[model samples]
Target: MKKTITFLTVLLVSINMYAQENLDLLTYAHTQDINFFNSIKNGTQVKEYITVSKNSVKIGDTLILGTPTSEEMSIRTYSGSYGTKARGGVAQSRSTSKKTYEFIQMGRPAGFGSIMAAMNGDAASMADNSLKNTTVIVNEIKTYHRGSKNKPLYVVMVLGELNGKAFGINKYLSVMDTELAVESGEILLKNRKMTRDEAIAKLKEAKELMGIDMMSKEDFEALKKELAPIITYKNQE
Candidate 1:
């Protein structure tokens, strides 16, 4: 009886530890600061790692960097894809027609390399050319109850800071908010939530939309495929 009790106690303790690990990611994501990675790595030649574990509550997933010793962040993921054209995601306007659509919060990255440096937390350092920073742009966060290969999981991206910085760095995990809505002509014609046809309709309806005339045809199509999953949650609503 004593042995059995000891085993149960150990199991409980293990479960608690696992829960704590998961909570750590959510906490860090909720409150990431400039100095978040000070403890994780230095300018050393070691490997850093980041891993994601599923969770509810828009917590998204966690990214851990470092070898045996890992530094992690609680990050969210969002996807946007073009409709039946099934070409996947296409570039659209930053604004959504629906006021309650998902939310995107961005942090100015000091540099691209800086972001990677921060993510790797000193695990690995890149060349000076690789260091660049830009305003971290967020598009979508896809949450799934269970995994499925057919569905595009999720895709999160950031526009690399242009000639301004050498590289973009991961500073804070942006929390994205999203929702569903009926077709509207007011929102940007090319938002993540709109399908290709819908976007075309909007363009014909409203030429004044900001992002519509910006991207080249090739760039626009690529954008569609890449961002296809940003609005995955639209189906849920």
Candidate 2:
């Protein structure tokens, strides 16, 4: 009787602890929806990212960079931004521009290596060159906001070299946020000129996100509308 009671108590405690781990994360994704296959059939698009799980990732893990577009979800988290210092994240514009510089998020990096040094200083403004059209292999993955929140918004903040020059990057953790940052080997078209299969794959990814509550139905619908024109491109599916 004593042994059984001890085992039950331990099991309950372990389950509770596991639940707490997901709570530590703060994402706009509601993560409750479950419909996945239909979205692909309906024609979405594919966005590849390295899957990030608290259980699998560790400090000092290396993340390869990718090309970044305005549509990319990886919002840049700087030291002084309200998003960086506060709980949750800072407000970001959907169609970001050079004027705002508010969310200098990235998809892929250019060849510039001063991303970190400039970001670490006062009144730092990122130049267009900071986002060079190049890829890199970096060796830093430290927590961004390690205060009341232990996880760093699921984005990768890396510090490594570009031709022996050090740089820094902080962005949202959507697909391709980093090469090894999430599920690998999936590719999504950045714009409207995607192949038939690519378009379907991308929408499928969005649908899955909505099902899991990671995305809202409204956004998913918007994506469908956005890609509607492509469904009838030359090479019909």
Candidate 3:
């Protein structure tokens, strides 16, 4: 009986150790593809989700990606540096750089308003105010195809980060310059989930709401010709 109990205890210890190893592996996996590099400043705890080779980078500064000798990804600044330095010195140092490798969210954005904010650059209210520990997805717009007569509508599903800060909040926590794109006649927006069909319907509805003529046969043909080579990214299942 004592031996049996001892065996059980050893088994439990092994399980715990295995669990710890698994956790370590997960933590290690998180930093495997860090693209952003930040220079350490003021000793802030750098966020794990956003990778920076250096813990802090200065404001209005350009940080090279991959290597110091490599191409410039994006210029960086922080909210902490703003008035004193760049206003959002901490924030700016933490946000993903434009040159950083772009990533798409695994699935649609979690909410409609969030999607809208993402699309319109109003994500500050919706996203965690802290740029350090946030996740934003970005996909390059590949193509825009006007549908056939039967389809009669266009579909545009934006799946990735529109730009830095997910929705317009700059590294300095200041409002960044914004550009608007019309998706299906509605401002291309984010922070919401749209199935392929729903995206199509919304775009169609937007067109109708805007009083734009439905795609004519010729327009549809021309649109398809236009979309022939644009390669958009899709969510990976």
lDDT of 2 by residue, 17-99 (tens): 42222122322121111232211111111222222221133233333433333231234534434634654454544443442
lDDT of each: 0.29, 0.36, 0.27
TM-score of candidate 2 to 2 decimals: 0.27
lDDT of 3 by residue, 1-237 (tens): 687557556644532331221111111123222331111111112111111111221122222111111122345554555355554325535435232111211222323333345446653231121222232232211111122222211111233232443443322111111111111211212322233445455545544644555555566555445443331214211
Stretches off by above 4 angstroms in model 2 are 1-124, 127-130, 144-147, 150-155, 166-237
Q: What TM-score do all the candidates reach, one by one? A: 0.18, 0.27, 0.17
Comparing 2 with 3 on TM-score, the higher-scoring candidate is 2
Better of 1 and 3 by TM-score: 1
The CA lDDT at 143 in model 2 is 17
Q: Which one wins on lDDT?
A: 2
By lDDT, rank the candidates, best first: 2, 1, 3
- In angstroms, give how far residue 225 of model 2 lies from its true place: 25
Off by over 4 Å in 1: 1-103, 108-152, 164-196, 199-237
**Candidate 1 TM-score, C-alpha based:** 0.18
lDDT of 1 by residue, 1-237 (tens): 687557556644532332221112222222122343322221111111111211222222222111111122334434445554543464444432212212222332223343444445652221111111222222212221112223221222222232344233434323211111112211111222444454455444443433566546666556555544543334221
In what order do the candidates fall by TM-score, top score first? 2, 1, 3
